[model samples]
Target: MPDEPAPITEHLGELRKRIFWILATLLVFSAIAFSFAEQIFLFLLEPVIAVMEDRGSKLQAISPTETFFTYLKAALLAGFMASLPVTFWHLWAFVSPGLYSQERRAVIPFVFASSLLFAGGAVFGYTQVFPLVFEFLSGFDTSGLIEQSWTMSLAFSTTARLFLAFGVAFELPVLIFFLAATGIVSARKLWSGTPYAVLGIFVTAAILTPPDFVSQVLLAIPMLVLYLLGVGVAWIFDPERRRERIQARDEESPGEPGSDSEDHSE
Candidate 1:
């Protein structure tokens, strides 16, 4: 006999358990990250710090508690990123029951790709976008009248936020690929929404990158490319098409369904 499906209450309980483990993992990692938060932030901001030095500007701590809280924020961000593999695993574990065996086999690739894409985006922002945006901003020095005194809190927080934003934005392709594969979205719909997606992408890029056209375009272009790639992937893996193929094959099969009905009639 076939196994019975789990009830909604059982599903909810399973979800709660996964959420609990995810949160616990984050808390533990964040505590560990707190010990090395300063090192991590310094590493991430090394390039920007160099640009600021060139402009005779440096990150400053006016208030006593500002540095402490800044490190805390950095720790939290690091912990969230560090725990991504576990988070992805839990998410896959929850969803795999509803998927075909072949789909279930994709969990490893999904987790690896998601973590890599996020880190790659952050690296891109650090290597390419930050230097350009900061260099352009630092170029404007008010004709050397007032000295530039950037607050530590604002600088660290803003850069960290932008790093996370860039990382999240880079996951667009994987997200679309998953949704299209699962039949939640279709290639035709994504194609039709290209104009609006372009507008939204630019707007998002503007928000995520610094206030510079070049930086915004830098982010937007890659995202647009990824969006197009996702559409192509969606066309290939779309479950509806797979179902149609199965249906066509069934129609060509002469007696599979008829034999079942005839056996029932006897």
Candidate 2:
């Protein structure tokens, strides 16, 4: 007989262990990142600083602890990015118990795809969205007006938030793939839920991005694109689709009565 499913308590225990390891990885990477927080800050600021230069605007800190805290947050964000491989592995481990042996074998591809999507999201946000957001916000500062000073903490926090948000957003396809693999969600189901999913994506974009139409819309468009991509992922891994194909093949070949079903059931 096939092995029995694990009890809920065992599943919960497994989840707790995974979370502990993931947190440990985050801490390790965060420590590594803290050593180079200054470099990360300077790299992130390049776009905004260039825009700020035109208007003599400067990034400053109001509170004494702002810089320290910002650096800490930056380190955390960097650590989170660096730990994507560990994070993805934990995610796969958490779900793999429910997957068929064939599905479990795709771990390397799953981890690689998830990590690549995360990096792609961060790059898109920095390259395409960041410049537009910085340009629009910076345009308001006129050199003639009172000195334009942006808070160091605010800038860094916003950058980190958007980077993290984009990275998470880009994991949609991977999420769908696993859901399909586990028989939790199918492409047909996703299609039926499209309207609600879109509403949720836009709302998430509005929440995560700066309070600007361009920023929010920029985030939303790519997410919608990813949603389409995720639907494709769902279609490919969807067991319902696979079952249908198998049934069709069996019907065409007219295999021995109940043999295919028995083999599959076994």
lDDT score, residue 71, model 1?
88
Best by TM-score: 2
Q: Write the per-residue lDDT of candidate 1 for residues 1-266, one digit (tens) a residue.
A: 22258999999999999999999999999999999999977987786798888876788989999989988988988899899899989998988888777888899999999989999888888788777766776677767786877787877866786688678788998999999987799998999999999999999998886677877887898899989988998989988888889999988988755898889899
Off by over 4 Å in 2: 1-3, 141-146, 254-266
lDDT of each: 0.86, 0.86
- Kindly give the stretch of ten consecutive residues in candidate 2 with the minimal lDDT sum: 139-148
Candidate 1, TM-score vs. the true structure?
Answer: 0.84
Clashes of 2: 0
Alpha carbon lDDT of residue 76, candidate 2? 89
Clashing pairs in 1: none
Root-mean-square deviation per candidate: 4.7, 5.0
Model 1 per-residue lDDT at 228 = 95
Question: How would you encode candidate 2's per-residue C-alpha lDDT over 17-134 as one tens digit per residue?
Answer: 9999999999999999999998988787777777777776778889999999888888888898889899999998887776668877899999999999999999989888898888
